[model samples]
Target: MLALPKPVKRAIAGPPVRRDGQQLDLDIQLLLRLLTPRRPQPVPPPEQMRAGQSFVDRVVAGPEEPGVRREDRTVPGAVADLRARLYVPPPGPDVVDGALLVYVHGGGFVAGDLDTHDELCATLAAESGARVLSVDYRLAPEHPFPAAVDDCLAAFAHVTAHPVEFGAAPGRIAVGGDSAGASLALTVARETSRDGADPAGRPVFCLAFFPVTALDGHTRSRELFGDGFLLTGEAIEAMAGWYVPEAMRDDPRLRIAEGDLSGMPPAYVATAGFDPLRDEGEHLVTRMREAGVPATLRRHPDLVHGFATSLGIGVRPRQAVAEAAGALRTAFALLGAT
Candidate 1:
């Protein structure tokens, strides 16, 4: 992995500390030290967007794990062709019956692409033994709201309809992502469940890692950890503004916490203790369960937002991803058995 910038390295040279009643993991503290001093500029002009993407790429990129074959392809999108990266693990008896996980990468709906999340997708594919498809959805300020959502729906429909084309089982499909991508997954799930028009399919399960469930940033977690933990309140606000139209900020599609999640598929939500989005992500699962939907919550009490993207830095993230992958495998196995 590449070394963090000089100023960031200097910031990490200190004893570990605690925040919000949780002891920050040493790795997370180091990550925060790497990110705290330098704030990323808002993504608008083409140049700024590229710079933001480059920064995240450096922060999260890591060596690809072995045993996974990666392929880059394009899927039909609502407007134009959307780029997608597929990760197929080595053949094995443990591989599910051609299960496919359509993963969306997080960049606050503004930055990040196929390359930034390349290793994470490979890790998921290798760990779960399921083909993982990482979508390069349209970003904000250019594509804006509904563009990314539309592309995700279209991509899911395409993959599910032509499972054989993607080497996936007919009915075994799941959706997952981190941060904004998680929000997109949930939104896609809600839309699919509501439409019921896709006689061909719906997601069987969902794995969200610290999702941005609501646009309103008044939650306790936001108030507590919004400043120091990489994802700050100002940053989230800026991204949300760019992604959502002023009048549609409260739309259920964007603010998933307010949406009716009654018929949603089984879900597993992972939250970081020091993440500003923690409360909302946990709350979404609680709402799902209350609506008679099967949902599970896993809170990493010592980590911060984007922990999963830092798998190369520590064991916690890798372990978390492995556990989520196990849950995904078990879900598919149960569906196959049924």
Candidate 2:
């Protein structure tokens, strides 16, 4: 694996940050503090945001895990053809047979693509020892609201129907993603496994990392950590404006927290300590459990939103993501996906 510059790594290895019974990771506190302005500022336009994110990803995300193979392919989506990448981990005894994870990349509905989350996805497969399909759904502005959701569902459907073609064993599909993608992944999990849904069509598990479930909830975490945490309230509103029209912001599909959560497969919802979306993600786990779905919410108190994307950068991030990937692997095995 590639390492960050010596100076950068050394800076993050400094003294710890503690507050509210939680310790903020040095990496997030330092990097985001350096980047964040004293006063909150509006994010750039969609195109600039995309470019900036891509550039930052390259600078921060070092490299893909060695020995994990990658293959690019086209997936049939609801709106248009979608791009996707399949990841197969290094050969190992723990590798599950006929199991796969359908992953979605997060960009708050606008920025991410197959390349931005390349190392992150590779880590998921490397740590879990399971095949992963990372989908590149349509972005906002060009394709809004249900466009991303529809594309994801279509990719999952295609992989489920033709597992062998995608280098997976049959009937062992799982769903996962981070941030915005986590919302889509959880949505797919809910829709495919809801009440009265066919057993054969349901996913075995859902793996979400700091998911964005509801924008209107105005939770305590949002108020406390919305600014200077890499992802801000202003940024959220801007992205939402581009992705969802005001008239349809109330759609249950967009605000998944208010939607039905019953009859879904077991889930592992991971959250960050200082993320504006933290409350909503944890809330989803709580509601899922209340609805009788076996769910677990793991909070990484030392991290912020997008920690998963920095898997190759900071120690805590890699560890955090690996823990979730391990859960994904266990879920696949325990649920008979292996």
Candidate 3:
């Protein structure tokens, strides 16, 4: 077979064209081009969940870093045992007492598991030089409100009590997550701090990526980015319905926007400009700062929701994760100094 010219092949495989009136980052545009084109289908919830998992499995890269060691374990949960993955990086020359980051995966509280976030967790461990524990909390609709929350709390407590076993310093633990996971992480931090939990059991800091701080969908970002962006308003509502009962939606525990932020751990909140949850995440950071909780916010104006999970696709997402990991290292350094 005759080989095509390089220029012609490059032209044929060019980046995807940008949508009209959309201002997405170039990397994201390229990622969209690489994804398989498909017509929207209305599958049953169970089937849709399975399809989502399959899609994640296909797109997300597998563990490729030899520096990071990964191990799976069944951790004790409030109601039952929860599946968890621990990623530990090799000790560095400067390593004194390393930190542990308990990460909760984001699937809108409906999908996602340890497998879906395996690569991301591994990257975090390697980048931050901290032991990363990714929790597989129960999903909603079947598990419902307080189920996932309870499971995450239990996992955090277990890890805090046994940090030495995970090769982490006893009092140098942090909590973080993306989307629904971020909300859960913040909740755990809030509850732990509020209860005057032991210093060793409390998170030194918290990190959130495009977290859904409130269930309300009336923010300006929601109006602007709710439809065309990856995370639609309809999808958010559906996940909220599946996760929390109507009566409990406004509970401070579930709605971080309405919760007390005083005494909560210092936080680093990152939000994408084109994400529906951008405003709420920003608002949460603002409130936390106003409440005397040290907090920082980083906004990526050209990116969309779930950009953190696209680490394998482009530079911007990787840059964002690297920046977040750097922030984590700073947080741990500050903890050590204190």
Candidate 4:
């Protein structure tokens, strides 16, 4: 094996030590602290406008670091147009042959958009040597279940079919997102496989960041992390109710863990320690492996949900994004080579 550089060696060695014996990684901790509420905000009523507003606020204001170019564009498709924010990394000319990461921003199918996920998308592109296409897919209550899923699938297909238009390698594509977006990525991957066109040669891999895999509302984390953790059970359940209609609550497309993982691509799943969806994410990882799909699950024991979106501000949250980014790059590297 080739010798790694000093920084890379150190990064591999793990995070720095603290005097209190509570050592934490710099990048991983970034999002954790940023997402941690400043002062406890009372849980908003389920499916209420105020709750949705609060959800958007946390995501948008979490991380706005310096140095990442952002651009907005209208992604034209057959049914509806999708709003997208493209995150172009700083000039690293050597990092050519960039792949396209069609990202669906997480908002529980209710709130959240390009602005909320700006930092993480840019950070991923810059760190992973890929172009991040953050899709502002339609939200819920106004849009609902299959609405966001349809938009995500359309946006991904549109981008993959016309890679040159987005300055990406036609055969190199990946899908990812945090929370609701992550769940959608899983759905789209399955749908793409069924069709078999794979304009970009199948999504190379999926980054399921704290994804809500099973929406039956029976996981233990939901009760354990119901209160103090950044995302309360009440918030997640409400978000689920808004994103998915009463009729399709049990649909495997939205509730990924219940679906067949038979031919899905390799996945790198991140689970927040104090998150209600943690068990679901872990379950998906286990199922992926059981179904012969390569997968790895990383649980941030001290972190809460939505950590990756806060990459630039907090200690643990930033570290979480960085860690996820590194995993993304490595996995995609293998996919690209294959």
CA deviation > 4 Å runs, candidate 2 = 1-17
Residue 217: error of model 4 in Å?
Answer: 2.9
lDDT of 3 by residue, 174-258 (tens): 9999999999999999988885677777898998999988876589889877775677787888788888888887777887866
Please identify which of the two predictions, 1 or 3, would achieve the higher TM-score against the true structure: 1
Model 4 reaches what TM-score against the true structure? 0.82
Can you write out model 4's per-residue Cα lDDT over 154-242, one digit (the tens) per residue? 78878887888787876677899988889888888777765455445468778889997777668776777677555777677677777
Worst 10 residues of 1 by lDDT: 1-10
Runs in model 4 deviating more than 4 A are 1-67, 93-96, 195-201
Give the Å shift of residue 107 in candidate 3: 0.1
Report residue 79 deviation for candidate 3 (angstroms).
0.7
TM-score of each: 0.92, 0.93, 0.89, 0.82
Q: Residues 107-210, candidate 2, lDDT per residue (tens digit)?
A: 98999999999999998999998999898999998998888888888888888888898878666889999999999998888878767766766788899999
lDDT of each: 0.83, 0.84, 0.80, 0.72
Q: Which of 1 and 2 is the better model by lDDT?
A: 2
Full-model lDDT, candidate 3: 0.80
Expressed as tens digits, the lDDT of each residue in 1-338 for candidate 1 is 12566455446546667776788877667766766667564425544855866676665656679889999889988888899998998888877768999999998888878887888888888888899999988998788998999999999889888888888887788999999999999888878877555745688899999999887668999999988777889878888888889988766788787757788899999999989999999999889998888999999998888877777765778888888888888888889889
Best first by lDDT, ranked: 2, 1, 3, 4
Model 2: lDDT of residue 24: 81
**TM-score-best of 3 and 4:** 3
What's the CA RMSD for each of the models?
A: 3.1, 2.7, 3.6, 7.3
